[model samples]
Every structure is written in C-alpha cells, then in structure tokens.
Target chain A: MDIQYPLELIGTFMFAISGALAVQDREHDLFGAGFTGFITAIGGGSLRDIILGSYPLVWVGDVWFLYAIFLGILTAFLFHRSLGKLRRTLFLFDTFGIGFFTILGVEKALSLGVQVEIAAIMGMFSAVMGGVIRDTLTNEVPILFRREVYASACLAGAIIYLVLNHFGLDRDPNMLISIGIVIIIRLVAVKYKLSLPRLE
Target chain B: MDIQYPLELIGTFMFAISGALAVQDREHDLFGAGFTGFITAIGGGSLRDIILGSYPLVWVGDVWFLYAIFLGILTAFLFHRSLGKLRRTLFLFDTFGIGFFTILGVEKALSLGVQVEIAAIMGMFSAVMGGVIRDTLTNEVPILFRREVYASACLAGAIIYLVLNHFGLDRDPNMLISIGIVIIIRLVAVKYKLSLPRLE
Candidate 1:
C-alpha cells in the first residue's frame, strides 16, 4: 500500500475524532456522533472538490471514506477520549495534518488545471477549514482566526511545496518533506508558545 | 429592473437576518455577524453551484454578495436590534426567505442539468443548510430538523414548480408563481404548526 494513502486515512481519522469531540457534550446518540463526525471528516474535502469543480464530492463518490468516518466516530465514542490528549502534544499531529492536507489539496487542484494562486488558496483552505467548520459547528471560536497561525501556516507550507515541485522534486517526496517542515515548525512554535503578531 | 431581482434581494436580506438573529444571543462583533450572515445568505447557493460544478463559488465571483453580507452585519449592528422589533412577525420573514431560496435553488440545479430528484434534494439543501450552518455555529439545534416542515416544504415546492414548468408555463411567470406558492405553503405551515413525522 502506498504510504500516502495511510497518511490520508490517518488524517481522516484525526479529523473525524475532532468532529466527534465537538458533539460529545451534546446528548447525541451514536448516529448523531457519526453524522457530525462524517461531516467534519469530509466537509473540507467536500468544499474543496465543489470549489475545484469536482463533482459528487470525494467522500460522496468513495463509500470507503464514509465508512472510515463512521468507524472513526464509533471508535472515538466508545473510547471516549478527550482533547487533553492533544492539548499538551497536539502540535505534531495538527501541523502534520495541516501540511499534508495542503499538499493533497494542491495536487488535486493542479490536476484539475486550476490557476496556481487559486490552487494555493485551496490548499490553505483544505488544511484549516475542516477544523474551522468543526469548531464553528461546536459553537466555539474557530481557531483559524485565533489561537494558532492556522491559515498562515498552511499558506507557508503550500508556497514551499509548490516552489519545490516547480524545481523538479518528485511530487510525493517533496510533499512528505514539505509536510515535515510544517510539522516541525508548528511543533517548535507550540513548544515555545509562538504566535503571529496580533493586529490589535 | 426585473421584479425578480428585488425578490432575490429580499430573500438574501431575510436569510442574512436569520443568520444574524441566530447569533444575537452571543457577543460577536461585526466581522462574526457579517461572516455568519454571508454564509447563511448564500451557503446553499454555494453548495448548489458547487454540486453543479460551478467554480470559485457564486459569491466569490460576484463580490457584491460579500458587500451585502457586510452591509447586513452593519445593519444588524447599527440597529442593535434583538429581533425584538418584529418579534410578533419574525417568523414571517424567515419563512418567506426559506421559500424563495428553495425555489431559486431548484431552478439553478435544473438549469445546470442535475436530475430532477437530485435537483429537488439540492434545492432543499441549499435552502436549509445555511440555517443549519448558522445554528451549528451558534451551537443550537438546526431548525431544519425540528419545529418546521422546512426541507420537506422545499421538496414540495420544487416538485410543484417543476410540474408547473413541465405544463408549459413561461419561465418568468413560472418562477414567480412557484415562489409565491412556496411562500404560501411555508407561511400556512408556520401559521398552523405543521410539521413532518420525525425519523425517530
């Protein structure tokens, strides 16, 4: 199996958990958890596909994605884990997820012949908007505009990946390397309490 | 000017207001209200257009859509109204907004060559998902699944509109007449406490 596929599945699971986490406080049954989880897991991809003019949405066409989301939600529900798992050391996974999602989004967009700028925007969106939607659905402030360098971090990763790819790096390897850069940067920042300069 | 254009504007404004009203209990600033209002106003259209493979999102292209959302937020903020001004009739505007949005969504989907069944579904989605997003953002139960015939009413409206068109009504007249029917159905439903049988 290609490593990228596992990376994507892992990312999907992380996101599904994130979604399930939001609904945990509610009196929802497993169905509600799964429903919310499925939306969180695939919502960003769904929007990206729609914006890139891809029909049927990624998860819509691929039943496996749906299965993965439902499975992930149930797993999270029975386990009943907490965000505290990520609270202390979440930097690595969050940054990795963001960077990897950016690469996947850009690759798909370029394949669709979208303009480079638009492709870059899509990549940034792909990385962060899932969490934003999840957070928003949970009635919390979207971390995109607050806590982390969220969208900025994605844009940075996208720029580097695109530049490296243009310089003739193999796409998959460059993606992994670029994703690593994002993960490392984000982890270091979070470890040191780093943040973007606030407008106020 | 096409009278339909005014209808569209009213629909957009009412939709924005519904979004605004959803957030009134929270202490959001102009940006949050505007952003939420914009999403509520056009989320369904954005979804429909994307499902139809429209790129860049309709609001992304028009620019005016954003302006209106900003204006709506400003309007809501300036008035600092709590939806209290029209408490007795707020449901009327909200119901009208949903009906108009649903019919327009159905027409857009059919025009883009979606199958009739899918078009009807898309219409309901476009009409209701914005409210869902708004409610989700506010951490409230989505109005679509509760308290109203909501999406079901949309489905009925779209089917009726399609049937009318199939019977050889002119396009302009068809749109207006169908929109009117939706408005009536929705209003009557609200007035009489009509609702669909729940899945549970």
Candidate 2:
C-alpha cells in the first residue's frame, strides 16, 4: 500500500475535526457542523480535481474517505471539551496536514500534466482552500487573506518539490523533504509571529 | 448560432455586474472587485461542471466567456454610479440570468446522464452558487440561506423542465417554459416578501 493513502486519510480526519470545532461557538446545529466538517475535509482536493476535470471526485469514488470524515465529525462532537484543551496538538496536526496535502497536490497536478506554475498554484490551493472555504462558510474573512505565512509555506514547499523532482530526486525522499519544509516554514512563522505585509 | 449561446453570454455579463457591485461597499480594490465579478460570472456553471467531472471548464475552454466577464467588470467600473441607480433593472436582469442558468444547468446535467434528483440539485446549484460564493467572499452569510425564493425557484424550474422533457416536450419549449417558471416564482416571492421559515 502506498504510505500516502493512509496519510491522506489521517489528514482528512484532522481537517474534519478542525472544521467542526471551528463552528462550535456559533449557533450551528449538529448537521450544520457536520456539513462544514465535510466541506473542510474535502473542499481543497475535490476543487483541485474538479478544476483539472478529474472524474469521480475522490470521496465520491472512495467510500472509505466518507467513513473517515464521519468518524472525524463524531470524534469532534463526542470530545469537544477534551479537544478544546488540545489546541496545541490540533494545531500541529493541522500544520502537518497542510504540509502533506501540499506535496500530494503538487504531485497530482504534475502527473496530470499541468504547467509547472499552475501545478504550484494548485498545490497551494489544495492546502489552504479548505480553510478559506470554511472561513467563508462561517462568514469570516478568509484567514488565507489575513493569516501569517500559511499558504505561502505550501507554495514554497510545492516549488521546492518541483525543483527537486526536476533534478531527478527520488519521489519518496522529495516528498519527505518538501513536506518537512512546509511544516518547518509554518512552525517558524508562527513561532516568530511572522506575517506577510498587508496591502496598503 | 444557437440562441442559448448569446443568452448565456448575456447572463454571464449580468452575473459579473452583480458580483462587482456586491463588493463595492467593501474595502476591496479594483483587482479584488474584478476577481469577484469573474468568479460570480463563472462560479456556478464551473462548479456544476466540476462536480459532474466535465472537462475544459467553460471559461477555461472558451475565450468568449472571459471576454464577456471582462466587459462586465469594465461596465461595472465605468458605470458604478449609474448602475447603482438602476437597482430594479439589475434585479430583473439577475433574476433572468438565474432563470436561464438553472435550465441550462439541468439540461447539461441530464445530457451528462446524472440521476434526475441530482440533476435538479445541480440546476439550482448552477443558478445560485455564484451568488453564494460572492456573498461568502465578501464575508457575508450566503444569501441562499436567508433569501426568499431564490434557489428553490431554480430547483422547481429544474424539476419542471425534467417533467416536461420526460413527457415528450421539445427541448426548446421545455427550456423556455422552465426558465419562465423560475422568473415568475422569483418575481412573486420578491413582490410578496415570501421567505422560508427560520429554524427554531
């Protein structure tokens, strides 16, 4: 089994949890929260696939992903209080999720024969678009436009992966290195309170 | 040329105008407003196509659509003051646009062999999702959840179209009749201030 498959499932679960938790303080009912979680987990990847005209959207084709999302939503509901206390841990998982998603998105786009530039954009889109959509659904200005070094980290990682792959680096090592770079950039940016300059 | 082709372009242009105008009160700049207009014009149809796994997204495959959107945005920028004064006219145009979009979406989905039920939902999605995305981008709750007789009208039209087509109505008449129903429903709802009951 490709290691990426399991990792993708884990990432989906983490994203779903975060999405559900995001609406906890709002007036959303269980169904609303669950819907939000579902979109947050699958929005980015499915959007990328859709734009690329890929058929049988990932979750639609694979019932397992739905199960994972369902389990994740259940976990969020059942352990909302406990999960609230685990903010730091959830932050780490979310960071890692974006990192993995970034590289995987880049790989998928490249394999589908998109231009390198478009692939890098698609990679960043895959990592951050879910959160963007989530924030939008929750009626907040998307954190993507306001947050520190989030999508930029994914773009950086995607470009690095492409560069390494062009230099004949092995796929597995390149994936690891690229994902690590994304995580590191995110961590450092948060640790230092770094942010992009605002448009004047 | 098919009459539907020119009507589609007109609909695209009208949607873009509404989108650009939506962000005018916000802090978004010209580029931001233009981007919003572009998405508003294409978001629904493109999303329907994406979910249906149709390739070479309409805007991506056709330069004419882009030109239409550009013209729409340009019109919005050039006639901001005059357009603001023509709210009633724009509302009618917007209503007609959605009406056309709903039927086209249903027709397209049926052509792609989606289940009738899914096609109905896709038809509504194709008409309303652009406004939903536009509202979301501007950090407002999607009007779909709060507005009166918008998407529901589209869904009703879609079902009507399907029923008529199933009963052996010709394609052109079915299209016109369904679109008319949508417009009439919308007009009555707005005229009467009809709205769905709020969740308790």
Candidate 3:
C-alpha cells in the first residue's frame, strides 16, 4: 500500500474539519455546514483535476473520500464546544495537510506532462484554492489575497521540489523534503506573524 | 458559421461587462477588475465543461472568446462613468445573455448524456455561476442566494427544453423556445419583484 494514500485521506479529513468549523458560529444549518465541508475538502483537488483535464474527479471515483469528509464534518459538529481548546492542534494539522497537498499536486501535474512552471502553480493552487473558495462562499475576502504567507509557502515548496527533481533527486525523497520545507515555512511564518508586504 | 457562435460571444461579452461593473465602485485595481471580468465571462462554461469532463475549454480552444472578454473589460473601463446611465440596457443584455447561456448549457449537457435533471441543474449553473463567483470574489453574498429569481429562471427553461426535445421538437426551434422562456421569466420576475421565499 502506498504510504501517501492514508495521509491523503487524513489531510482531506482535516480540511473538512477546518471548513466545518469556519461556519460553526455563522447562521448556517447542518446541511450548509456539510456542503461547505465537502467543498472545502474536495475543492482544490477537483479544481486541479478539472484544469488538467483529468477525468473522474478524485472524490467522485473514490467513495472513501466521501466517507472521510462525512466523518470530518461529524467530528466538527460533535466537538464544536470543545474544539476551541484544540485550536493549536487543528492549526498544526491544517498546516501539515497543506504541505502534503502541495507536493502531491506538484507530482500529479508533472506526471500529466504539463510545463514545469505550470506544475508549480498547479501545486500552489491545489493547496490554497479550497480555502479561497471557502472564504469566498462565506463572503469574506479570500485569505490568499490577505497578507498571509499561506499560498507562498506552498509555491516555495513546489519550486523547491521542481528544482530538486531537475537535479535528478529521487521521487520519494523529493516529496518528503519538499513537504518538510512547506511545513517549516508555514510554521515559521505563523510563529513569527510573518506576512507578505501589502501592495501600495 | 453556426448562428449560436456570435450569440455566445455576445453573451460572454455581456457577462464580462456585468462582472467588471459590479466591482467598479470597489477598491480593486484594473488588474483585479479585469481578472473578475475574465472569470465572469468564462466561469460558467468552464465549470460546466470541467464537471462534465470535457477538455480544451471553450476559450482555450478558441481565441475569439478571449478577444470578446478583453473588449468587454475595455468597454467597462472606458465607459465606467457613462455605464451607470445605461443600467436598463445593460440589464436587458445581461438577461438575454443568461437566456442564451441556459439553453446552450442544457444542450451541451444533453449531448454529453447527463441525466435530464442533472442537465437542468447544469443549465442553471451555466447561467448564474459566473455571477455567483463574481459576487463571491467581491465579498458579497452571491446574487443566486439573495432571493433572486435568477437561477430558477434558467432551471425552468432547461426543463422545458428537455421536455420539448423529449416530445420530438427540433433542436433549433427548441433552443429558441427555451431561451425565450428564460428571458421572459427573468424579465417578468424582475418587473414583478418576484423572489423565492426565505428560509425560516
């Protein structure tokens, strides 16, 4: 069994948890929260597949992903009161998920024979777009456009992965290293309250 | 050339105009407005194709669409001051654009062999999702969810198209009839201030 498969499912679950929690204090009903959770879990990956013309979107083809989303939403609803105390844990999971998603997206795009540069963008898109769409749906300016270093971390990791691959690094080690860099960047950025400079 | 070709371009142009104008009073720069306009022009169609697993998206396969979007953005920027005075005319064009887009989306989905119900939903999606995305990007609740008769008008027309085609109506006449229904529904709804009942 591929080690990435279980981790991918866990990442999806964490994303859904974050999405569900995002709307917890809002006026949304259970169905609305579920819908948001589902979209947040699948949005980035489905978009990546759609743009690359990949058929049978990942969740559509794999029922397990749906189960994972359902479980995540359920977790969010059940733990809403206590979840506030788990903010740090959730943040760590979310950051780790983005890191994993970024590398996976880069790998998938490269395998599809797209230009390396486009692959890097696709990687960033896959990690960030779900949250972007979530914020959009909830009527907030997307975090991507905010002063956060969120997407930049993914892009940096993607570029690093491309550079390493170009230098004949093996796939497994490249994936691990790139994912590590992404997680580290995110952790450091958040710890230091770092952000990109605002446009004048 | 198919008669629908020019109409499609005009519809795209109108959608872009609406999107750009939606952001006119906002703090967005020209690039932001242009990006909004482009997405509003292509969002629906590209989303339809993506969900249906169709490749080489319309704009990607045809350059004229790009020209139409660019011209639309240019028209918006050049006429930003005067465009407000033309609100009624713009409304007519926007309504007409949704009408045309609804029928075309339904036809494409039918041709792709989607279920009739799914086709109807896709038709509505094609007509309204651009505005939804645009509203979301601009940090407003989507017009679709704001008690507008917008998407329902498209759904009604799409269902009518399917029923007519199922009863042996020819494609050309069916297209015209379905589009007319959508336009009429929209006009009447707006004139009468019709809206969906709010959830309790």
Candidate 4:
C-alpha cells in the first residue's frame, strides 16, 4: 500500500471536520451538519471531476471516503467545544488538507491532458471550492472572494508543481515540494493575518 | 421546429433576467451582473447534465443561449424599476421558466434511462437549483429549503410526466400537461402566500 492513501484519508477527515464545525452555529440539526460536512469534504473534487468528464465521481466509486466523512462528523459533534480551544491544531489540519487537495487536483487534470493554466485553476478549485460551497449553503459570503489568501496559496503551489513537471522532476518529489509550498504559505499568511487588497 | 424550442428560449431569457435582478442591490458591476444572470439561467441544467455524465454541457454546445442571457441581463439592467412595477408579468415569466425547465430535465433524465424516482429529483433540481445557487452566492438561504414550495411544484410536475409516460401518452401533450401543472401550482401558491410547514 502506498503512503499517499493514509495521507489522503487524514486530509479528507480534517476537511470534513472543518465543514461540520462551520455549520455548528447555524440552525442545523445533526443530519444537516453531517450532510454539510460530507459535502464540504467532497464537493470540490467532485465538481472538478465532473467538469473534466471523469466518470464514477471520486466519492461515488469509494465507500471508504464516506466512512471517513462519518468519522469526521462524529468527531466534530462529540468534541466541538474542546476542539474550539485548539485553534492551532485545527489550523494545521486545514493547512495540510489544502495542500494535499491542491496537488491531487492538479495532477488529475494534468493526467487528463488539460492545459496547464486550467489544471492550476482546478487545483485551486479543489482546495477552496468545498469551503466556498459550505459558506454559500450557510448563507455567508465565500471567504474566497474576501480576505482569505487560501486560493492564492493553492494556485502558487500548482504553478510550482507545473514548473517542476516541466523540468522533468519525479512525481512524488514534485508533489511533496508543492504541498510543502502550500502549507508553508498558508501557515505564514494565517500567522501574519495577511489578506488580499479589497477592490474598490 | 418543435414548439418547445421557442418556449424554452423564452423561459431561459426570463430566468436570466430574474438572476440579474437578484444582484441589483448587491453592489456588483455589469460583468458581475451578467455572470450572475448567465449562471442563474444555466446552472441547474448544467449541474444535472454533469451529474448524469452528459458531456458538452448544454451551454457549451449552444452559443445562442449566451446571446439570450446577455439580452436578459441588459433588459434587467435597463428597465429594472419599470419591471418591478409589473409584478404579475414577472411572476408569469418565472412560472414559465420553472415549468419548462422541469419538463426538459425530466425528459433528459428519462432519455438517459435514470430511475423514475431519481429522474423526478433531477427535474426538481433543474428547475430550482439555479435559484438555489444564485441565492447562495449572494449570501442568502436558498428559497427551496425555505417555505417557497418551489421544489414541490417541480416534483409534482415531474411525477405527472412520469405517470403520463408510463401510460404511453404522446410526448408533446404529456409535456404540456406537466408544465401546466407546475405553473398553476406555483402561481396559486404565491398568490395565496402559501408555504410548506416548517420542520421542527
């Protein structure tokens, strides 16, 4: 078994928990919260796949992903109060999830022979769109259009991955480097409270 | 040419204008308004096609649809205040949009051999999802999940279409009846200020 499997699972779980947590303050019951979590974890990748004409959508083919999402929702429900105090821990998990999803999206699009620019957009979408959909469903402006530097981080990482691919770098190493870039950029941005300049 | 074609074009135009109007007070520029209108008109059908694995998404194959959306946006931007006074006129257009989309979605699903139950759901999605997404993007709760009874009308129409198909009714007449049912239900519901009972 490849190491990527476990990493991907961890990323999925964290993303799901993040989604569930976002729904906590809203007037949602357990089922609604769980559904929100499931969608937040899977929505981005599923949309990308559908646009690329990839069949059997990623979650549709794998039952285990559902298990991961269920576990994530359970964790969020049972320990949300305690988890709220651990902001740094939650931030780390989210950072890693974004990194992993960005690479996954870029690689998948590239494998399907999409243009590099489109592949980068797919990468950013994979990393950010789940949260966009979640925010939308919860009746809030998506953070993407606001102060978050999240999509920027994903796009930068994807560009790095594409450049490294152009240089004939190996897949695993390229992925690791790209992920590292995204995680570092996001962490630094969050720490410094950096945001994009608002359009007038 | 089938009469459905002209009706569909009119429905699409009305839906686009409705979407553009939704963004009127949201502080968006012309491009933003136009994009919102285009999405509102096409989002539901595009989502259904992607989920059903239908390629070339409806708008991708038809440039004429873009022209209709542009015209709708322009009309909304130019005469919004005047149009607002014609509430009944706007209501009729929206009703027609919903009815036409519901039937078109159901027929597409049936052609793809989707299960009748799923096909009904798809039809409802096609009629209501664009507005749902539009509201979400604008940071509002989707009307479908509220007391609007919009999806219910689409679902009722789709079920009627399916039953008529099962009885081997002619396609055009069946479509007309289903569309009529949806429009009447919606108009009556709105006029009476009726809504679904809230879930506790």
> lDDT value for candidate 2?
0.86
Residue-level lDDT of model 1, residues A32-141, one tens digit each, is 77777777788778778766677777777768777677777877787766554655444466667788898899888888876565577678778877777777755667
Worst 10 residues of 3 chain B by lDDT: B26-35
* DockQ winner: 2
Residue B48 deviation, candidate 3, in Å?
A: 2.5
Ranking by DockQ: 2, 3, 4, 1
Report the Cα lDDT for residue A70, model 1: 74
Provide the DockQ value for model 1: 0.12
| Residue-wise C-alpha lDDT for candidate 3, range A1-200, written one tens digit per residue | 38889998999999998999889888999999988998899999988888888778889999999999999999999997798799998888888898889988988988887767667767987998898889888876776655347788898999999999999999899988998999898898888987653212
Candidate 2: tens digits of C-alpha lDDT, residues B94-144: 888898899889888988998999999999999999988887777777879
Quality class of the docking in candidate 2, CAPRI style: incorrect
Give the runs in model 4 whose Cα sits over 4 Å from its true position: A29-32, A63-67, A196-200, B1-45, B55-128, B137-139, B144-200
Pick the winner on lDDT between candidates 1 and 2: 2
In terms of docking quality, how is candidate 4 classified?
incorrect
Query: Which has the higher lDDT value, candidate number 3 or candidate number 4?
Result: 3
Answer with 2 or 3, whichever has the higher DockQ: 2
Off by over 4 Å in 1: A1-46, A54-124, A133-200, B27-32, B88-90, B197-200
Span of 10 residues, lowest total lDDT, candidate 1 chain B: B26-35
Candidate 2 regions with alpha-carbon error over 4 angstroms: A1-46, A54-131, A137-139, A144-200, B196-200
Report the Cα lDDT for residue B195, model 1. Answer: 74
